[model samples]
Target: MLMSATSFLASQIRSTIAATVHSTNTLVTSLKSSLGYLGKDSSTSEPENQSALSSVPLRHEQYPSLQPWKGLDRRLKNYGYTMPVSSNYIAPRYPIVLCHGLFGFDKMGPDAIPHLQIHYWKGIHQALNKLGAKVIVARVPRTGSIIERAEDLHKILSTTMEGSPVNFVAHSMGGLDCRYLISHIHNKNYEVLSLTTLSTPHRGSPMMDWFRDNFGVGLLLQSEEDAMRKLGEAAKLSKEAVQEASDALHSYLQNVAGRVMSSGYRAAPNPSPISPLLNKLIPYLDTPAYANLTTTYCKEVFNPNTPDDPRVSYYSYGASVPQIPLWAPLGFPWEVIKAKEGENDGLVSLQSARWGEYVETVEADHWDLNNRWRLKIGYDQKPFDAIDMYMNVATRLYNNGF
Candidate 1:
């Protein structure tokens, strides 16, 4: 009876081993399929194409206004990106200068900290260099007016490129800077062959107008005074009573604003609590950068004064996502832009992004254009690859003989 029990146990062990082997094989096969490795036709084993085929159709059905990828090149239809860069791609004749937009930087953080060093252009510069294109990533003040940033960019290019003609591929506010440079800052030291702008606010953004109207201290105070006046009229209160109420509201708002500023100061790297006088003065600081982005300013002031240069070829591309995700950092801003300007890529509207020789709009957001948002933990599978789009930009420049 003991011998019989031992044989049964050995048989059960063999069966368990076989089951484990089968499950392991099945899991490997599933992974291969998901990665586009086990396609029926092996020749067209592009993972992006597979992903696009699955996701684009569903998205188009849900959002009819979203540009359909039906007739576009199979590779670009879904994600607005090209195939991986290969040896056959031609490099542009002139060196490509990449300009960053508002709050942009060349690099940030220390390299010693893992995943801390952030690049504004990300892997785009290296990819362009790998394709035999000389690339320069231009850095300027994060929040300076167009002219101020343009002057800085001019100085940097004049020193670095040293008279070499370049193609300006500016993104967002960077486009405005390049346009200002091309029109105003004509240093005979360097020549600009072409200016390609991606999602630039050439006309201006309604979102900026919204921010000014809703959040500006002057506007907020005016709105509150109007409300107080209406309350006095309805309640049959005396004019003095209304005035007193308005003054109290103003004082309360000032105290609240002071506390908010103090908290922000304390959160800074080296905290020195700002005095009440400085807190009051902060709102009146002359920050032209934010003011310059307003629709009224861009339409009435900047665009009228800064005309496009005839000597340089100008091309602009707009970006749009069907809808902002719930977790997107730009969700509220996207809604604001969408309500006023229809479809937008969070910050700049498609209507505003248009300028000299408008190119086709692509499927991306403002941050996606720079590959910044894609670095987040759960964003690895995003279809739009900024590297591929920039590669296509270089190819287009080469084809145009720039």
Candidate 2:
């Protein structure tokens, strides 16, 4: 009986080992086939034709074990998936005009490193153009009064597109500039078909006030008040840093300002004059103009003056990324903005971003809305292409015959 039991145990052990070996072999084969398939896929097609995040999904085809089982695929069909690349399929009736906001630029840095020649709109311009959209990147003043910047934009559009009507996709303060241009500068020579603003502070930002308080009134002045302004003027500012956070110190200072401003408004019912220091500091900051963006100012001053143009169609896209450590590049200011204004896209709040036909709020920070350029600048979050957003917008405009 003992001998028979030992033989039975040995047989069971052999069967178990055989099953394990078979399973291991199957997995190894699946992995090898998946890797081989991916290698072939890469060499077979040009990089541009493929989605940036396609490799993971493409590899799954070779491995049945790795893929979702039967019914799960149907449920997840629409979730977190990218639209297939439609080459040259997104042409709009009018040219697509891209307007950059305050401290924004068309292109910056040396041409030597091709990636460093990053546009404020990032990869969207090139991608749109490839898709047969006539994309024009407007180079406006980095920091100036709305009127000044609008006039500059007027000059740019007038000179470049020869006064033809174009679809205006403005970001941040650029939306304010377009509105000003439409309200005040519309004529036979200047016409806009559509105005789409992403993360614009239609209702002014308290950050402007924060700047005045922290750096004193001199911060707002057009002339150099402190090292910050001087640095802004002299430095060839990083396009990402300019549109997003300035630096670690500035971000920390902004948090302090946000807290102070929130407390001040809570303590006082009436809006008081900005500190006497601001009065002493030169008005170079366009204090009144910047203030016009504030909720109070917009409701009182700006909205009253700049009504929507009936001819130009209006749309706005808002963004709200998860706070802080979600994207370290956006820094501490996002926390402050989130604290003061519910949800924010690092800079512009969702409420403040609302203007014209409220399109949709996306899950992206101000910078995340565009290509962070992971391969190039090392500041990227993959699978969230700003180009895709722009393409979708352009496609919609085309479908709408705009």
Candidate 3:
């Protein structure tokens, strides 16, 4: 997402502290608020909000754009999008923040946290930039949860893009993290323009039951930790409202059915001899929300959202790798998609991938979602034109104001 200068600075200071020093940065000023007490807490403090990923300032060359959008959507008025003709549109390519998924490796030398895959984000970022967006791959000690990640983003906004309007387009769980930041942690003020999720197991993927119980789970991934965090949050509540929420969520998933570990989805190889005992645990857990996030799943996206982001719209995208053999990579095992229908770039179901406020589909796997080695090797795998997906989103976000 796009953010102003002031928002970026406040967030940076917080991230440098939270990640580098292992501290937290919750108290920060909104772009419009005075930063008079930079490091000081208000004496008669009111309820504080969690900060989000720090927004960063961009060099003029970074955005390389015309003036920022001067729109009058009333919502944009406060966020500093300014009011001007559509022709004065600013290319939103200023600074987009890209966050890695759970257990994503972060490199040392502080070399901007190296992305594990060589092709990771290289294609994605290049395409976004060609369409006028600057990509910022962010690293933290851990996102732990979308809410926490969102808070970090909030902090980034404060420290980095202090004066600018920011937009966020997150992948999978990252989208969930954005929602947590905007809905629960936010102080009911700031506007996030738009948010989109990619293959986010919003209702919770059956995969989690496998990852933690079968494979393993770690706080190394903020979103992974969030499963526990939300469980914790869910546990603390006894409100009738909360019960209704869970019930609604439950009812929703039961309807949009898909393959679980059952239906022989985990066949042939069964489990690898190397980790056969561990693999055995997978087929046990029932998939609760495989197809639940579909429009038919629930009446609406499950959110504690206030006003439901009149300005910020929601979208989702997923890959569909159906015929996954009995073996695959670490992130996605072949058992999950083997014998399924359609091709899911590699990990997400194409139908699931289409969950955008507006959806776009490309011929790519989960890896295709990112830049790849370019050799394009894989059966049933399609080489995605990252540039296409990038431009598709860029033109929409910039022109549509999300």
Candidate 4:
């Protein structure tokens, strides 16, 4: 989830792979192209575009931001980014749609806020827009079963692109939504050119089992009715508003739990009996949706149930923190996942995140994979820039003729 954090750990990654060579070649070519796109020239003795390189903000302070998270914004607003003179500024033939994971909000929050103020994709859309890519941020509900979320996304696609084909770049559960939509929503004529999933739980996560099993206290807090009443009391919002937000929160949690809690796990029976209040509030915990996410279900049922479209290229990019990071809030889950799954991005293990053409892995947690490291308040070390990674994705897509 994209909010703050979670807890659990594992050490082994299990998956059946088809072609490791495809992963290597695609990763190497993409990195090389991205480096070249940023004005680095391996062919030349010196920097090919020294003039363009001179304009880039080289240091954190030089970027003009005391807030680390806003550094990318400052750089974009001030210096701006330009591709090498040899390459085209605008790349992708089709529009790029950014699909967000759980807890993702299309706009910042509430009706009064401006769009993109606190985007789920952070400044990625802005940065891509600047580079002449046609980027549309899809606003599906933060949580829901793949079908429910996909339905929402399908409606958005109908309105946004009419029927034009698009390249989708999704994160976490968003990838599942994309896969669901691509496979099921055939009437829409929405030709999905490529699907790139980032740190998605393809085979599901055991963390969901742990949360549904032992965390009764936390579940009580998230149970729809409680969250709504609490917010209603705290914010003094209208009854209608509170109910709506509460319903959304509940739906989100339903999908979150649905993504991992299934029949195969050691988790106690669905509609966890640990908390009577939670059981009452979330009576429909074990649905077909939830069942679809279990490793057993996914491997034995869902994978075989869902067929990959030969026309649409599929790529997966997974991440791992290796160790607990400076983001203390995310450390618990990261550590837990590390211990149990070998290494993870605090949520989905790298193995669970793999799908089609497996891309290179990164030394980043799930949140940081979306450039959340930029928002680390106290951390001074610049880990990595997700912007570059995204740019590289767009570049590779462009190079491939879509």
Candidate 5:
């Protein structure tokens, strides 16, 4: 059931989708596979046939590094991005890499973007370019566990930057993926000069559980573990592959990224079965193994409340957003979140987002952290002017040079 098992045949995607998704989810929504930006294609045929994607390739570079990959050069322009003119004064030699988060892609879904009037990476990339630092966009795998993604990041770094990334600006769970790479994956050979994350789920997001409660449609929207977990589970087909990838992800993140990441977004990973495919895909959902896995990566063990970033440092802009509590009567065990109230974002809580040492904050929502929105996080008034905040953060990074 590996994507590489067969050539790029149209039916191949359909068959893989059928196996990957159950009858229920397929009926409700499509499964996540080697999918591409929808609507952009504007094709009469099903996406499987029309899509030229074999999983969004992961390779990115921002600084006009010498000998950049041809593929990278094309994608940089394809994204309609270019070297942004710096503003103010921040002399940092290292450029920036803009990482995409869940639902961050230009073509995530029909309803997710376009109308929102706010795109994080594009907005920020342009902002920082004007702020002075050269910006690069990291087109990472939208689907795959942190380990898999970290490995993808490794590939991108190796090929594009020639082994070391000058800096990174990630968002959402993308932060977690990067964390796993730096803290756990241990890619010491590569040099990561700095990192800045926006609205990332440093902890897990309770939304994961919310998605499980609403599994019928959640899977199609976004996997709780995001793309990495789904891809990791799928990749679990081979343990050696899993270990190798996980090791690489951990090495790059823990070793390389940890040293260079000056700032980042933080959020918690709250477990849930939002997507039926992911829920079913979890080999150990609601079981001891599930708890063990989560616990292993929870605040206590893997990405705990530590001073990991005292040297490189980290800052956050998140607080808990209330969700109606669920009181599962007697059947559920202690492991069930059971509708606990705590610091959170619109989905992930603040306590969950807590990682590294203290930095600073504003009356911002998880999304509001970026200063680009020009408003605030609320249904009534859109958060920070997206353009303003984007420029602020980028300029700040370029100036701070952390």
Candidate 6:
């Protein structure tokens, strides 16, 4: 009986080992196929058609030099993501207009203080210009409605390009501005040949909705009456004092709201424990961008009104980071956005970023899309050079005869 039990136990162990080996082999084969290492006809020697290659998903072998961060495979497989070749970019036919997004600027400091000037596009504009592309960095309002931004963009383009056909490469909210311009604003001065958006929230972001619902609406509801009552009591000593004070308070609140809400992502996270002083301040901070950027607003209002122009070619690239570190500035917001949307680059989701041709998705966050390398820390799972990506866009436009 003992001998028979020992033999049975040995047989079970052998079976388990065999199963494990089979599963491992199957996984390896699947990975190989997904990475473009298997299922190819070995006899085929002809190069793939350029148009056909564009449609085919990029493979790991295509980017031989991409060195992802160490241990990234153990945490989250890099999969050798899609990024443009580092060199040899063909300049597009028309000048490339680089449009900044919400709360963006061409330069921050005054011209006299050139050493301290901070550029929105950073190294991107200079890199593109070096590659023989005529780059125009457009300056628009930091925090304005889409219509307002579009109007400003149109004016800038008309004056700068001067009847020259131009290609627009917009990031974040700038993409919406360009779309609005293309669809609604008709200008005879300059022609829009094409628009390529990088990580733009075309459909709108859930983060905006979350901010408005949780903090913006609550602040407005709780503080307005209290602030007015306090102001009225303070000004009651004089004969028309209350009325004058009320008017002054209303105007002051409007100005404060614009300034505060317009700060965009730079604003501090929503703090729940509102101090007495903060209660008065919070209610006055109106989100001017909320009406323009909420998912509901874009889907129900902006999209319906802003249809794509047939004359212009539209293409877009979305981005995503595998993980958001605990200490990352976008950590809380990333979780908030991820809860509603499946995958995102800490700001815009991959699904929401898709528009027009839908080129490809890269491994990056919102700031990384703008070529802000200094902002990226301890989250470099993939080597996605923003400069290279822009150059690739220019190359694509050139190839398409834009």
Whole-model alpha-carbon lDDT for candidate 6: 0.71
Question: Model 6 over residues 68-109: C-alpha lDDT tens digits?
Answer: 532243222122222333344678888999988878889888
Q: 65 in model 4: Cα distance from truth in Å?
A: 22
Q: What is the alpha-carbon lDDT of model 3 when measured against the actual structure? A: 0.45
| Distance from true location, Cα of 211 in model 5, Å | 3.6
**Could you give candidate 4's per-residue lDDT for residues 1-402 as a string of tens digits?**
533232221211112132466687566556445545343444533254454444543443443332355545434422223222112234578899898887776666656756425556666777688777898888876655565678788888888887788999998888988986776455575678999999988887666645544532122222332333443352344656645654664475565552222233334544555567766655444333443354544454445545677889999999886565646676666666666676788888998899999988987778866655345565443366677678778887888789
The true-structure Cα RMSD of candidate 5 reads 23.8
Expressed as tens digits, the lDDT of each residue in 276-358 for candidate 1 is 56545546752446655777656755666566777899999999887875466777788988998888999999999999998
TM-scores for all predictions: 0.62, 0.60, 0.50, 0.62, 0.49, 0.65
Query: How accurate locally, in lDDT, is each candidate?
Result: 0.71, 0.64, 0.45, 0.64, 0.46, 0.71
**Backbone collision tally, model 5:** 75
User: What's the ranking of the predictions by TM-score, best on top?
Assistant: 6, 1, 4, 2, 3, 5
| Number of the top-ranking candidate, with lDDT as the measure | 1
Off by over 4 Å in 6: 1-87, 110-114, 217-279, 375-380
Q: Write the candidate numbers in order of decreasing lDDT.
A: 1, 6, 4, 2, 5, 3
Point out where model 3 deviates above 4 Å. Answer: 1-90, 93-95, 105-120, 188-190, 212-308, 330-334, 337-345, 351-356, 374-380
Query: Which is the winner by TM-score between candidate 3 and candidate 6?
Result: 6
Clashes of each: 0, 7, 73, 14, 75, 0
Candidate 1 lDDT for residue 329: 76
**TM-score top scorer:** 6
What lDDT score is found at residue 26 in candidate 4? 65
Residue 297 lDDT in candidate 6: 57
